[model samples]
Target: MGTFLGHLLPGSFFILYASWHMFSVFTKYFLSQRALATTRDQGGTGSSGGGGSPSTPYYRSTCAHVFPCCPRIPMEGIVKIVLTTIGFLGELITAFEDGVFVHYGNAQHMTMYFAFGLSGVFDIKVSRGPRPALPNLDYVALAMAFAMEALLFGYHLHGRTPLDVQVHMLMLYTIMLCAVATIVEMAYRRSVLPALMRAFFVMLQGTWFVQIGSILYEPLTSPWDENSHSQMMLATVLFCWHCMGIFLLMAFVGWLLNSRVKRMLGTSSVYCQLERRLEKGSATCQEALQLTEE
Candidate 1:
């Protein structure tokens, strides 16, 4: 799995972030009250009958879509729609540019993760599990992930020719995205604020992966280059592991968000079971209180 995924690290990161973005819209709408949801504009896609296209076609397409059958579509959908569109645009944008970063150095990569460590403390919102704060384990995991992004870039720079400048720059962006995601993960662990902010960033990471695959398997470059063949391979291995970690992190966040929304809604039968358990505990406490009185 690592071998195949090693070929696809950055791509996994972007896709997972996109998936997270997709879910957040549903989450907000699902959690809203009916009357308030109705009063708000449905999506900006002519659903409100403002101007552009006819309301019937927009509603037709929207109704044609699923998931928001009961609640209105989130206005946030407009932003998400735009983000997803832009994420794809990165591929084209990178293609037009020289496709390499100018100037690379070890010092530059280290600052990336430092930013993440700092950001985590500020963007705290907990939308997951029983806790109001992100789990301690999440901080540990994020710090570790941040280290991996930096370390890999360190190796990449160490092997560079002056020509690798643009490539290093892309690596820098990957480092920055991972750094932001790591901090966001910490903040997320603290409380599920807006993973959506760093969510679109996965695309730039995917650009890294596709580039790696080109070097390894693509006809353009050899898997082994002279300056740091062995070290580069090690970087590849780490890159793949990091991507898997990235995917798992996204999935875990999704699970955390799901659990949180479930608990918030209290609609699930399992939630009822938990409520009953809580009531039983309350009764036990009350009996103890009565016995003390007696």
Candidate 2:
């Protein structure tokens, strides 16, 4: 990475993607639970009306409202394509900036280019037109992304300052955790914990990049020549501060979303009716909510 700009640009994109992913996950879960509760209420009413008629299906679509311009298109897929293209372009530009292509003879750039480019292709395959029967391609792309990041860690390990090496080491661990979480999500589709953890790790990685840029750039607080015992201790403290900041941010986001969902449920007439039904000795709504929670 050249300087603060180099790291900040990509880090911003990753943070945006991570935020979007978290919002999508939370919204989808909330809406799907509401839909299930509504379906149960309808079914109960229909059953009491003498005829055993099937309840109308409530289709829960993905959150496309974030981009009002193209409600039909998946926002996540579009973001993936845009961010990955930006990443590829950034790498190409960096290569050109370094004079000759061979001058930078590092595999990190090339690996990242392939990782982002291939991920965009897979995102298109899974998201464009009709939804694919198998959307596991996205996770495969994620695994590739993680692999490329690990390769970058190898490049960082050779002839770097102690602080730089430590940062990269933490990045590698975060990326590995993200990859494992993605695999868990693929295997257990209903489990929300893995997906949430993956998003959290991605956010952590973005924050770490910001920390790296700060330490390498800003002259006043730069750890460029941090080799002394005291200097190293200060750097370690800075790292822990960054980690704590990110954790607090995550906690705030979680609380905000939880409050918003609870408010929506309270204001919803359908949800109110469902609650009344549940109070009147109906286990359907309760069971549906339990299933959705799991």
In lDDT terms, which candidate is top? 2
**lDDT of every predicted structure (CA atoms):** 0.40, 0.60
C-alpha RMSD between model 2 and the true structure: 7.3
What local lDDT score does residue 130 receive in model 2, on the 0 to 100 scale?
51
How many residue pairs clash in model 2? Answer: 0
Give one digit per residue, the lDDT tens place, for model 1 in 42-93.
Answer: 4434232435321211000010111223222322223334443443343334
Candidate 1: stretches off by over 4 Å: 1-5, 17-21, 24-136, 163-165, 181-193, 215-294
Candidate 2 residues 161-239, lDDT tens each?
7766776677788778877877777776665566677778788778777777877786356346645666567767876
Instruction: Provide the RMSD of all predictions against the true structure, rounded to 1 decimal.
Output: 18.1, 7.3
Clashing pairs in 2: none
What's the true lDDT of residue 106 in model 2?
Answer: 39
Instruction: State the TM-score for model 1.
Output: 0.36
The stretch of ten residues in a row with the least summed lDDT in candidate 2 is: 56-65
